[model samples]
Target: MSWTDGPFMGFDTETTGVNTATDRIVTAACVEWRNGQTRERTWLADPGIPIPKQAQDVHGISTEYAKENGRPLDEVVIEVAKVLETCAHAQVPVVIYNACFDLPLLNNHLVRLGQPTLGERVDFLPVIDPLVLDRALDRYRKGKRTLGALADFYQVRGEDNLHDALVDVRQTIAVLRAICTAYPQLGEMDLRQLQEYQRGQHRQWAEHFNQFLLSKGRSADVNEEWLV
Candidate 1:
């Protein structure tokens, strides 16, 4: 069966802000799809800091709501980490949209909470990042490459609640499936080969983006790392 056939995990997080170093995960979701069925786990964490109005506007999770109904940040992080670690050990492909952002942010949270980072716990591999793949495959296609944009581009039906963790994960998986349908060769690749291909594609995209920034007299700050 193709990698897209079954047994993949879709992960997504709604956070306080864009800075992975300081932002906290307010909500996260993992949806494991196998044999045409899906099991989902979701978390709402009291991030222990004010959820800025700007961020709240995006995911609609306010600090007050989180504090009232959420688990402790440490508890949420531990549970999420366990799910990720289990996926790694099982070699299940984890489908993430912008993996570089989410993976590093989760690692930062683990370090902040005095827990072992994901890298120390397991070899997180076989990641399927539709963002990197879409850019690589459709280099010149313009407009936007946000999850919502790609969903629309790929004709993947998405819910109105685009920014919610669960909704985003579901849409991401749909978009990935649509991408595989368009690029049949991607369905033929082994998990490891697909992982390496995305890694290389991300690096090349980063380098090119950095050069564009430099040409515009801006700092070339994009990290070339795929999962950092």
Candidate 2:
């Protein structure tokens, strides 16, 4: 596939909490950039549970508001998965900041509702994580490791608001482009090759990060295995 023949779908989600099995998705946003153009979409779902004050503060969607205004969780999840699966079939990578979190959370949501989970085939098609790429590219950099900070470091803009999934997805594209500019070698690689490169980079990042923590006299949490 041509590297630029996108339908590169970038995805992000806002949820009740970070626990994939327990928490539910409250909102999600996706951007489908196809053949150099883009279409954006967002979904807000009732989550079927109270959105805690702390979680609501992050994404600005409360439980009562969701109950009144949001669509059913199943409907939202199905559409989101379908949109992503379509893009993947077109040889597009669903660019996410942390696919490990968002993809699994979405799958768990489906499983919880007695629906089919988004299988590995639905997930592994050329996925990209700007967070892991940034960590890999700048392994020795100090300070914050957030999406916004990476945007700043790469000189990629439009990350003033992060909790909004749609907005974050656009910024993620900018971050990817910036990384390509910073590391010209990446521009030569096709989608599948790039995905493999990212997998290696993520593995190295986990090793390096864990080593840093250990050097600082801290024990790594087992729960953080996903990040590794």
Candidate 3:
């Protein structure tokens, strides 16, 4: 049996900006599911940088607010890393909506702060990306692809907002279930195999999206920073 036979965790984070190398984490959440039960943990950190108004507008985290109410960045990062490391050792897949962004952004924070980088060990563990799966399976689908949009498409309710970390994690789990239901063919595979399958699908989906952009005379920026 694969790791999917046991427990799993869903993770999400809201940051100060799009640059993984420079942006700071404002909020992060993780939801763990096992034996039909779910538990969630969230953290708000004082990023020690000015949260630009544009970024704050999206995630609703202000510099003043975080500095006054949030925990220290080092403390929050350590706690999150410890939990992630423990889960990784247990063979639990961390289901992130967008692994390319969150995973690297997290590692960057840890490395900059002289803390242990979760990516060093956690990279070997399984990671499931529902966003990639959604685009891969529905390559031709139109309109938005944000979490809220995907939630609406799958008829998964209770997730209209995007800022609150814990709420977003709960909604992410719901969206994952909806995706599994919508794409039954891919849902039957074990965790590791499923991850491998999605990577190929992601490549095809990226090409399709790029082609669509080209037809409109617009060039797609391939950099990950443009993802947000």
Candidate 4:
């Protein structure tokens, strides 16, 4: 059986804003499908800051709600990092939708809290990012590449809501399985090769996107790394 037939983990986060460096994590989730068994952990964090309405609209977690019921950010991040470390140490591939956003955001928070960053924690964790995979495999496919769109294209079941970390993480795995089913070539590659492929693919996309940004006179630097 392929690695896909064994175990994998899904991780996602909902934060105060898009600025991964400064924004706070409001909620997070880690889901594991191991030996065909599903285990999930979810956390809500007070974050100690006001959550922008725009961000709150996306995930439905309000600052007031979080303050009332959520755990402190430092404590929350500690536990979340442990879960991530344990899974990745086991070499279980982590399925993250837009790894660039979530992973950096998680890492930044960890660093600020004086905890070990992902790079300091693991050698190299195999990550399956469906968004990166889709763009790599089919660069010319025209429509939206959001998780919901990919789920619809692959006929994967999506959650009723899009931004909830748990729902999004679960759907990400479903879409990955669908991608592997449709593209056997992907599954044939081992984890190292797959991550290398994603790195090359990310480089390709970054170059392309950089040019597009330059054309429009926009200049936000895109990180070239695929995984942390």
Which predicted model would earn the best TM-score? 1
lDDT of 2 by residue, 91-111 (tens): 677889877789889888777
Q: How far is candidate 3 from the true structure (C-alpha RMSD, Å)?
A: 2.9
Tens-place lDDT digits, model 4, residues 20-123: 88999999998898775789999999999999899989999898999999999999988988887887788888889989888888889899988899779988
Q: In model 2, which range of ten residues has the least summed lDDT?
A: 219-228
C-alpha displacement of 121 in model 2, angstroms? 5.3
Candidate 3 lDDT at 207 equals 73
Q: Candidate 2: deviation at residue 30, Å?
A: 1.1
| lDDT-superior candidate, 3 or 4 | 4
Off by over 4 Å in 2: 1-5, 120-124, 214-219, 222-228
Please report the candidate that would top lDDT against the real structure: 1
How does residue 63 of candidate 2 score in lDDT? 94
TM-score of each: 0.97, 0.88, 0.88, 0.95
lDDT (0 to 1) per candidate: 0.91, 0.80, 0.79, 0.87
Candidate 2 clash pair list? none
Ranking by TM-score: 1, 4, 2, 3
Candidate 4 — worst ten consecutive residues by lDDT sum?
219-228
Clashes of 3: 0
User: For model 4, how many clashes?
Assistant: 0
lDDT of 1 by residue, 1-228 (tens): 888786889999999999999999999999998886888889999999999999999999899999999999989999998998988899998999999989889999999988999889986557899999999999989899999999999999665669999999999988988998899999888898898899899999999999999999999999998874
Per residue, candidate 3 scores C-alpha lDDT tens digits across 90-184 of 87878888778887888888898788787575555677787888887887889998888888889886925666777778787788877776667
lDDT of 2 at 120: 50
RMSD of every candidate to native, in Å, equals 1.1, 2.5, 2.9, 1.4
Q: How close is candidate 2 to the true structure, as a TM-score?
A: 0.88
